[model samples]
Target: MQENTGAGYPGDAGVTDDFALAGVPDAFQRLWTPHRMAYIKGGQHQFKNENDCPFCVGPGRTDEEALIVYRGRTCYVVLNLFPYNPGHLLVCPYRHIPDYTDLTLEETAEFADLTQTGMRVLRKVSNAAGFNLGMNQGVVGGAGISAHLHQHIVPRWGGDGNFFPIIAQTKAITQTLDEVRQQVADAWPGETDAE
Candidate 1:
């Protein structure tokens, strides 16, 4: 066994680095990949109106199931199909407007509620050390689904990093979305569905 570096890492001496980690997640940095970012670009289909939005789809659509976690008359939360972290999620108003001004006062309050709920649930399930919360409002601002503005709430960890994004350019996820979904779903029931 190798001695720990006392810097929070085990010594590398005699350590046979397992390449299989590339598949199973040995480092958080390798998780970010071109395929992932390309999808994050969120510019596949351009719609002249908000009607073309997938987030706007009804729950009964029977297509790609809307990852709606919490739903109210005006606002709700959804799991990000493409995520920056395990519990990455989106909070938005049901109204199909890109401009933030379109959301009513009640809807904004619900949005705040959803954000708090999402953070609480993420903390319970992932044991996450931190979070990255923001909104990408347009193509110029990194909005993939710019037609309808949504807030992204990303869960984070302290050591969930490596040289990949700075070097090889990847971000490795140590947990599976399935596992993440299950844990987050179970953490606080209503984060996925409103109480």
Candidate 2:
């Protein structure tokens, strides 16, 4: 009797009599970040009062430490520490308001202005194909930091999304936060009409 050889598999090259298993070869590469476990596990600290909020305390921190890209009078732009994409940023009012309606006219204007500027700067610096820009208002709305109001500016590339994010729930941020912050800061527009 003839024995079966795994010739159907792409890279099997006819499995030997030793019964070794082979996998199909592909061009895809993987980037695993187990460190994100800490961010995921520390869920208790995410939805707290203003005093304990990162956005409330963020302005007081040094630009590099806080990953701040630009500081407007009423609003500021900061890099997202846990980014969905490489140059992901967040535009927020200094006030730790939980809702959009809580913003004053000045705060609202600057928030909109800074968000626009962040998109422009990200485009200039990273040459992003597009962006995902919006705010998650509450816990039910998918806000990780529900006590603070902030708009996310996620830069998107043509083929950035892949199996990893879908299958493993991992996003591969290509650049470090500090590196992206500096690049965006340098390319930021100066004295815009919104200012």
Candidate 3:
């Protein structure tokens, strides 16, 4: 802590100056997101084995509990627990494969289909103007959970980029993950229609 030498300020005399270390105020306003500590601290999202992998374990639970939007024979669409935007989604294969090349023919086909359906559902439910779609293969490739293969479908809108995400490294999600999951799930097209 800085020594309070009764320095310059309006009321310097006899004041304890508990916040002496706080220093001068600036034009920036801080947005404290305590919820993000889960990601930073390595919560359930961090998995050491396939048995605990979120993508593998998520399907065993109910759709609401898993934040799953849609299910197929070989793949499923679920809302991203740590989303870049409000309706960000991930299409993951049922198997615990670590890379895209590991997927079987059937898994590959369904994975691609589910990604398309997820994008359509996000557009219909959230009126998203654009999307960011890709897959992070391994730890070095930026996959948070590198034990599973999943494709990201991040919905985007005009002016979605703000000082918060760009400068502060924080994104302001307008809705809860469950809310987005339900909206996207309800808007999902039937199997026949999706094709």
Candidate 4:
């Protein structure tokens, strides 16, 4: 707290000194301020609007319209809209349910099958040697879309992680989403199976 002159005492909160002590450059600090203000509070998320919810009616609407891999009776696979890698995909159920408990037995089975198929397709498309399969069961952990449950199959390569994500918060770069979608969709179940 900065010393307040005798007329009236107002706290300084130490914000300026804290940043200065930490050696944050003035040019870098000014550059980051505008980016912080860009968020629109209370904006409707894409999934919240059912009319435009891609996981529900969007997959069945068209083969090319949605990037769905296999449309099962209860669930389907779609390329991630924003992905960590080229072939990143998520297996989501038709019903907008949040957790594993909400999914029916058939829905669960379909998700499992699609996850396996997605991994296989990723391996072939990206020539990836390994995959990191995971899910966020609920909020308070990692479920960004807590109202809709899904599984991610992230294709891994030898040097996928360099210093960017760790040091500068910069992500590893990627190919276009359309190209990645085309590659995965083209290698449908009927296409090829590695022995």
lDDT of each: 0.71, 0.81, 0.81, 0.71
| lDDT (tens digit, per residue) of candidate 2 on 9-106 | 43444555433453555577766666554544456365577777889888999999999988999999999888888988999899888889999999
Query: Per-prediction RMSD in angstroms?
Result: 12.1, 9.0, 9.1, 7.5
All candidates: TM-score: 0.67, 0.74, 0.74, 0.68
Worst 10 residues of 2 by lDDT: 10-19
How far residue 21's Cα lies from its native spot in candidate 3, in Å, is: 39
lDDT at position 174, candidate 4: 74
Residue-by-residue lDDT tens digits, candidate 1, 1-195: 667788755566734566432345544543445654675565646653656677777444532256555566678777788776678988888788786667788888878877888898888777778889998776667678778878999988886655666475566766766666566666656434564
Residues 136-173 of candidate 3: C-alpha lDDT, one tens digit per residue:
77765666777788899998999986767656777788
Q: Candidate 4's residue-wise lDDT over 1-195, tens digit each? A: 575556464346544555554565565522233332222222225556556566676665675667676677788888877677778899998887777888888888878988988888888788988888888765554566655788888888987856565457567657877778787888857625543
Clashes of 2: 0
Off by over 4 Å in 1: 1-45, 61-64, 165-170, 189-195
> Candidate 3: misplaced stretches above 4 Å?
1-46, 166-169
Query: Candidate 3 at 106: error in angstroms?
Result: 0.7
Candidate 1 clashing pairs?
Answer: 30-171, 30-172, 31-171, 31-172, 32-170, 32-171, 42-144, 69-192, 69-193
